[model samples]
Target: MLISMNTCSEISVVDCKETAEKLNNAKRYSTIIIVGRIAIEYIGRAVSYAPEGDRIVLLKPDGSLLVHESSKVEPLNWQPPKSISLFSCIENRLKVKSYRTNPHEELLIDFIKVDFIKICNIVTSKLLIMGKESDIVKLIVLNPSSILNASIVVGTDISTPYGKIDILLKDEKENLIIVEVKNEKAGISAILQLKRYLEYYASRGLSVRGVIVAPSLTDEAMAMIIREGIVYIGIDQLINGIKDIYRDIYSYTKFKT
Candidate 1:
């Protein structure tokens, strides 16, 4: 359908069901222009007719016509008329709907144009942090036998001589599973950190099975863990463990699939 704004002398083509479906599926658009018509029922009116097309011609306030298609239209050999208003009435309709639906969203979107980079940076940072944390949790959930064994108890913020341990698992018999997580690299200090956790828990009358988890670990750090008798677990291992738990809990083979 073609919607024209009297104030801005601009026109916009409304999308039809078929066109919207195509866009939804492949999410691709070509520059081809198509024109047709459709019947519409107005809220308070009996019936209405509208142009059903992929292209529309917009009349600028200056009396110049610009051809628009599904993508964009370049003004070809057209001189703009000076008397036309710069703003289009069609945009006012969109603004009205936007404000009615979500004024804050509209305001933020409008302001985003001015602070695009800043807004993008903030959004990206938040998404990255959330994604990292989610990945870490998913990893821990993978091995139910490791996480939920009757003897296992996962503890957070356990104090140690070296630093605060993020998570520590202990069996019912008080055998400790020292876990130290670093979202990024398992640094030089990670091995030592786990050692400290093991020692601290052991001193508290708990035997330890040391485990270190990180996105990646340095060769030196890995060697240190092996030398120090620590088991190293990556995020993917944890995710697998979680999947096993979900399978057991729901009694569904689909999870295993």
Candidate 2:
């Protein structure tokens, strides 16, 4: 989707201060663009099936542009357009123009209601920080004897062909224990995920036990757990049971020191 200033209609004189303020408030997730007329007059058409849904991507300070459709995940329609530049024509009135080589197609953005100019700061730590899940994994990894009596956490987030196992531990008898941690209720899919990890370990000559750790387990999930011979540890049970063990261990270590 291209916008040419030549065929575009003049809406209003652009306000520099208002434009800066509007651009400053840009977000990371999704952006809305209004094309053709000024922002106020063509709100309905721009937001609807008109040319407003085109996503504008700012290239470098040198002025390269990437325009794509919003409906699909992949931008399969992007062709390398050359000599792209943004010009402030007549006060606040702005225009973007680009050219494609060989066939020589000129792409122009005559009028733009919304355009993202600067990079917006996006916080990514929230996505990686799984509160409940991380807490449970930490407790199990730090103090495995609390969950797997006479066991110790050997590794965590262990990778296999099937998928990654949340926690890996070893029991007193030297058998490998694979744990799958879920913050919410253990569902059928969770049981299946653990089962796949178990199969990967079982194929080897190693002795492995599969376990699911969650707040609760559905009846169907529990049935699968029992059939698959996988252990289910409730979050509440672990907290109540493990805290006492941790306290005793801490006290003992403190006394030794």
lDDT of 2 by residue, 1-257 (tens): 33323322222235745543443233222122333332111111122122434355442322334454545665412235344333344345555444445554445554554443443332334433335887779878777886678898888878798887889999999999998999998899999999888888888878999888898999999999889899888877877777789688777877776
The best candidate by TM-score is: 2
- Residue 183 shift from truth in candidate 1, angstroms: 0.7
lDDT of 1 at 222: 84
Model 2 deviation from native, Cα RMSD in Å: 14.2
Off by over 4 Å in 2: 1-130, 250-257
Q: Write one digit per residue (lDDT tens) for candidate 1, span 54-119.
A: 333332322332434456357321223331212112332110011112112111011101100100
Least accurate 10 contiguous residues by lDDT in model 1? 112-121
Deviation (Å) of 108 in candidate 1: 29
